[model samples]
Target: MKHLFLTALLAVAMPAWADAVDTLKRFVQEVRSGQAAFTQTVTSPDGAKKRVTQGRFEFARPGRFRFEYDKPFEQLIVADGQKVWLYDPDLHQVTVRAMDQALGATPAALLAGGSLEKDFRLAPAEASDGLQWVEAVPRDKDSQFRTVRVGFRDQALAALEILDNFGQKSVLQFSQVQSNVAVPAERFRFTPPAGADVLEQ
Candidate 1:
């Protein structure tokens, strides 16, 4: 009789505990076994501001990642736990920065840290404008973006919408996501060509 009562109480309390913030935290941990291969689409601002590139991503824990753009151009961004390298073969340019400083207020930090509860306040995922939205506001103003709205279907991450200070919105939709794959060691490391200009930004 006591077991039955406890089970019923827990069932009633479970949904309340599975809040937006908690869900994000759980998802991060679920994907943290080491690596993932996901595609990203970055849409530039309005009026044909720039090219929309589709890219493949490889990510490993403890600050390592690779972004390889495919369409429009071939470019790569790699972070090897200590330094970040952005290389564009067409432009023959390489940009390097310290990893910690480069990740300032970026979504990668949230994904890599699994610390959503520390950085964000959660509200209900709303349905407005004929779309589903989960609103998340950063706890710190220093965060690069003002808000991150994760769109969902059946509680899976369907899309991520980021709003910057200028009110510009960048939305990323992830497809064909394979989590916990064994990423190659070379993907996270970068070597610039001898003649390419290396700018420290």
Candidate 2:
């Protein structure tokens, strides 16, 4: 009787594991655009130091997004399909890189739409903190991130936990998520302020 009960338990638990990866696939395929407020906490490799930042993000499919950091510092990152622009208001500088060179195998690529199976080795991760998790290991050997875990709550994107090559961990918790909304086209456009230094890579 005990063996039979164990088998039944295993059958029930197995589907939950697949749910995480399935949720991610559905999210990537169905949600074309989204905007959300996020809190990002980054921890040092030794866990002795930490930094927190708050931001608002908006993204459209096929390579367009904007991340505007508001607290602690004012910075903006915009991907305009062709180039990725990083602007530092305090430093009065703008940096630009080709989008293809900047986003390959990164979290932005995952969320901004791509060939997921080609870029990542996807697997179901153990559920934690009341969220189902999917772990994505980038197939690009030269990628900066070691692993990226996306967490979903009730089939909605809840959080992203990224572990980098240097052992640093960054966790982004999203709130006020609005999925499949029409984001303004201007959100992905960036222009350097007059007199600000611009560097292109």
Candidate 3:
């Protein structure tokens, strides 16, 4: 019978890859602090082309984070655990750096900060759309998004799919996700809107 339907399709795809690697190890270990509302897409690498944006985010793990980009414009990006601001109120501009020199292992430092198996090398990624995927890869060697695909649905963290190294692709899609709540320490503090135009390093 065709090897029992290929062993029952690997027993239902190996328990959905062990529940999407236990929902991304319980989403970076119990979701310390989070807030979300996002929808981003920027593809271009033979996939025709795309560009959509809408955001509102906040986070506070070991480092910190905040991004508030409304609709197809307006932007801001903070980090404040050492610095990494990037505001652009219609190009009035403000850009700083030094969050370990601008996010070391990238993917926004593995989605806001630290210790994912000490810099990532995870796996288990299959299901799509409905979510449940997880694949990180960047043991740091000057990484600039070479692979990172995190997604989960019921367990939270809606989606994310960076993959760059010339093959552009960035597809984030989170919505109303609020975990651990209570985030406000100035939302990662980025104060700089007086005539703008500041650039540090």
Task: Give Cα-based local distance difference scores for all models.
Answer: 0.63, 0.87, 0.78
On lDDT, who's better, 2 or 3?
A: 2
- Report the error of model 2 at residue 30, Å: 0.4
The candidate scoring highest on lDDT is: 2
Question: Candidate 2 local accuracy as lDDT?
Answer: 0.87
lDDT of 3 by residue, 1-201 (tens): 000011345548677766776677777778878988999999899999898999888888877988888988988898988988998888899989888888776766776777676677777767877887878787876777788888878888887888888898988888889898899798788789888889897
Mind sharing the TM-score for model 1? 0.74
Q: Residue 30 error for model 3, in Å?
A: 32
Off by over 4 Å in 3: 1-68, 76-85, 88-93, 98-100, 109-118, 123-129, 135-149, 152-158, 161-171, 174-201
Q: Model 1: residues >4 Å from true position, as ranges?
A: 1-20, 33-51, 127-133, 152-156
TM-score of each prediction: 0.74, 0.93, 0.33
Each model's total of backbone clashes = 0, 0, 0
The digit string of per-residue lDDT tens for model 2 on 15-116 reads 666777778888888999999999999999999999999999999998999999999999999999999999999999999999989988899888887678
C-alpha RMSD for every candidate: 7.0, 5.8, 15.4
